[model samples]
Target: MCISRRNESLNVAGTMRRGVCLAGCALLCAFSACTMGPNFDAPPAPRAERIEHGEPVADVMDAAGAAQRFSNDATLSRDWWTTFGSAAVDRAVTDALVANPTLASAQAALRESEDDMRAGAGVFYPQIDASFGASRQKYSPLRVGSGQPPVIFNLFTLSAQVSYALDIWGGERRSLEALRAQTDAQRHALAAAYLTLSANVVNTMIAYAAYGDEIAATREMIALVGEQVSVTHSQFTAGVAAYSAVLTLENEKATLEATVPALEQRREQAGNLLAALSGSMPSQWIAPEVSLENIVLPAVLPRAVSSELVRQRPDIRQAEAALHVASARIGVATANLFPSVTLTAGGGYGNRSMNALLSQTGQAWSAAADVTAPLFHGGTLWFERRAAIDAYDQARAVYDQVVLAAFEQVADTLRALENDAHTLDADARALATSEEALRLVQAEYEAGTVGYLSILVADAQRHQARIAWLQGVAQRLQDTVALYAALGGGWYGNADG
Candidate 1:
């Protein structure tokens, strides 16, 4: 009964010791939980409230019946390409988003950065390991002056150990912050990729339409020149017009014809570019026929505030994220100036005989604390910390540059559209006057009141006016598309979805 009581008493003492150990560990954790370093703060806003340029005019006077206006309250949809209301453009953008390797690459990079952040979070927990070993070795007691014989013995050891680095300096936290910021940067990069890809697809489609218009205009001019050549030949054969007039008509026809092949080649090149942007070979993809007439210009364009522009632009957001990462790295560097603390604990059971490995008498345990601090590294750490600060400053400058560029893009697009509207209006007027002049010259030539040269000049002027009008219309449409792209492609809040 006394032996049983003694064993119970030993058990109580062992439990008390373990309880004390756990309590001490808890106290240490509570005391060392604070991290040392500068906490992160968001960068300040720009001093200016509005953009450098004045606000654009509300409505533009277009030659076509469709007039476009700007509205400060207008908001762009997530799929801004759809605003053009062209099924072909929508399909091209959709297909590119699904199959473009560049977007897939960006997505993979974002996943990798997120995984790296997750891995860094592990620094908050303890590292635990279990080990087991068995060995046969010879030992001599004679070295201890016991005069014991040398003997071979079998030994076994089993242990589980845990070690934890206390984040008293907040180095791990700052490192994790940097990693998380990188993940954020990658996410923004992916959004930027999406924006770029969609814009390319839309821009390529617009160019294809422009090329088609030019080709059509060239064909019309060729037909008109052919008619003039036929008239000139008939008059020359009848001796009513000089042979030199016939020759001039023929030469003019040849000049107009020469432009057709170049226009066709340009059209084909634009088509090939569209195919490439769609992630298919030119031979495999059939580019859709597009024209400015089929595209609906957004009646009311969205013009965001300058500050909102900074928030919406993906490249600018990406640059800001990079700056955030640099700032966090400064904290990490500063934390390195402090000492690191680690706690270790281990327990094991062992015996020469495998059957007695778990015996109560064969158990062993240990606990320890350690500290390490860098004494010197030739000023590397100090300079690195300064370098981190400098890098952050650089990132901030780059972010500002990106914002400025984004605003510039919007301004350029707006001015182009405004100028295009005025040009289109003038082109329409010129074309009408040229057509009227051509009709009067044709009547006069038939009535023998004017020479064949007068008809040719009128026809050539009218053809040029027609081509100029087509080009002006196409340019206006392209600038409308550019405005959409400049405004962040309407993807600020919807990229993750």
Candidate 2:
């Protein structure tokens, strides 16, 4: 009989172990079940070899006479501003990245999203809570059909409870997924902010330098014209020329002088903008002097194909992340239409006497499983699911628009760079011709072979040509900066490190 009883106990123990194993397998299978929405796939990139459709982005012989080549497979550096070879430009970018309020706001947003995602992840695990209580109660047993006297008693309770809302339809998981995608979008947004701030700083600096150069060129022209006015005034006094000649030269000088204040104003505005970008008050900050001569045109500009640009550009990536978030929201809404399961278990000690609360007789335990199914919600769940689907469609459309805009911007910059090269070449030649003509005319006047009016006409032409050439140089540099920006400013490298 003892042997038979021991064998039966062994069989019962085996059955219990098998039951536990089966329960564990069932839980695992439930967790691995379908997530209730269409999985997201990234939109395929455009099937083009180059960004621009017409002539390839060719080497630009810019105003500085440097050949700026667009390399299809060049590794773009994170600190692209440094490629300008100006320490001042690099310093300004670094300072802006560190202190710009816009960038700081983006960083804070990213951190908040990340924290929310992490907090959302806790739903996958059981929620455990502990509680302790002490209270005085009056009990009346007569209500339970017993004629016992009413008694007042002290009750003490200590308990721990655990509850978990199982993600049977993956609603919670999908919610967490949406949070993660939103975090990703914010990260890309931060990158876009960095790109924009750096590009703005560099472009503004370029303008400041160009305006200063133009001001200098105008002053030199004014001096030359003033010299002519002195000579013409002497000639008028000697009765060798009309007084109108002196008036004409003086008028030209005054017109040239009038442009100086305007140029100075623009230069000051650019400086103030730079100070703001660097997170300093304009009155408290002075921008470093950046000369066009000190700025180096990038020799080999990095170019990405259409397929690569979608991935490189932060705006495109942010759009993709938004699409992902919308897709996940659809799953969450769809999951809400189905039943949700929750498992709860609690154990506690309770007693009228505080010292007896820990006794086995006072110990109690309970377990429960609950299933909540949506029955009648006035079609709210159904309409919500449809709305999520519509939102996903909207996100997809927006993503397509962002991608198209990115490609267009890149194409426009490429064309601008190419045209800038041709334009600068023409301007340089024009300036050179004007200078030669002025020199020749001045020499002829000294040799008594040409009239003073000839020199005046030549000087005016030289002044216009000089201004044009300076503008061309500045435009080429700024457009080079634009190309870098259009290519996403190499933020990926910075993000990785």
Candidate 3:
């Protein structure tokens, strides 16, 4: 009867122990689901549909003969630079993307962020580790008042340990969330780098071509002025013109010649920039001969609404990711205010002899659950939470500022395009009128109806008009490039490509 009663008591104790374990597990799970701090939501897109408050972008057409059309519904190609229709430009951009060290650095940073996040994820699983050790130790029972003899022994141990810090308040989870957001920020940074690099390459190419064109036009002006100088000298020799008239023509020719060197210097600088962009020394690579006339301006430019612009720009996206990280950090800080629970289990074999370490007689094991709660920290935890909140607010403000800046840039580029077209149209008309006047003056001079001075004035006016026209053409092309860049260079659609 006593044996049966003892057996029943043992069964009751076992049931109670099982109940305690089950209750502990249930508590852990329930607490783990409660994540601290405010959840994050993306800011709403701007309400204004139009990028600019003024006239519709679509109505603004290029009036300089080649009408540039803006299409709201058209999709921008990922390889937007290709729209310029220059194979050399396409090749340059491709080479830059492949070989630029800055791009490679950004890519490497992105990979590092991803790897860090992966490592942080390990906290979600139990960490298991195995270890082996051997040590010589001396033991004395006299230290504990047992009055036994001291003994020296060699100890051998082999063990496996498992531990997991319960994410009861979601601190570790929030940390992981922050890491993931950081990874996202890195990804956007890489995109921003790619966009910036391509735009720089194209802009440098355009500048190089424009400078070349301007130099050629200046040389033509110099030649025209030289001819006038010869005419004035002949008139002076015939005693029909003053010496000052010849001097004036000579001065004009010298001024026009002076400009060529400066223009040549600018052209060389642009070429060197192109070589650098292509990840090569100027000595190793020469910029291709990309003429202003060869570059085909894109006719149909893609125009995105304000909402889409927010989504498309890498800077905006990166700002958003930063906001996300800040939000997650707030959670992490809040969770820090609560208790952390860590569960550990260890099983080992130990013996004086290495061969006997694995024997059942030498077996040992342990299991424990530790709970550490912050009782007081001199307001450190509380202030940290406040700091995280401040950081989140700061990130949110930065995000708003970034969005505003992006809109401002797009609006400004759009206006510049419209103005460029108008300026180009006016400059073309001016050039034509000046050319006609010069032609008439030359005819009159040949017929002996006008003096060489009249021809000189007309030629100078035509030269000025030609320079203005060339500038207008280059400006229009550059503004077109700006519009493409302002629209985020279609990196979103062409990220993989």
Q: Once superposed on the true structure, which residue ranges of model 3 sit more than 4 Å away at CA? A: 1-32, 439-460, 494-497
Query: Which residue pairs clash within candidate 3?
Result: none
Model 1 clash pairs are 36-169
TM-score of each: 0.85, 0.89, 0.90
User: Best candidate, TM-score-wise?
Assistant: 3
Q: In model 2, which runs have C-alpha deviations exceeding 4 angstroms?
A: 1-32, 53-64, 142-149, 445-460, 493-497
Better of 2 and 3 by TM-score: 3
The residue-by-residue lDDT of candidate 1 on 298-384, one tens digit each, is: 778876567567667778778888888888888888778767789999999988888999998889999999988889999998998
Q: For candidate 1, report its TM-score.
A: 0.85
TM-score of 3: 0.90
lDDT of 3 at 458: 88
TM-score of 2: 0.89
- Model 3 residue 481 lDDT? 82
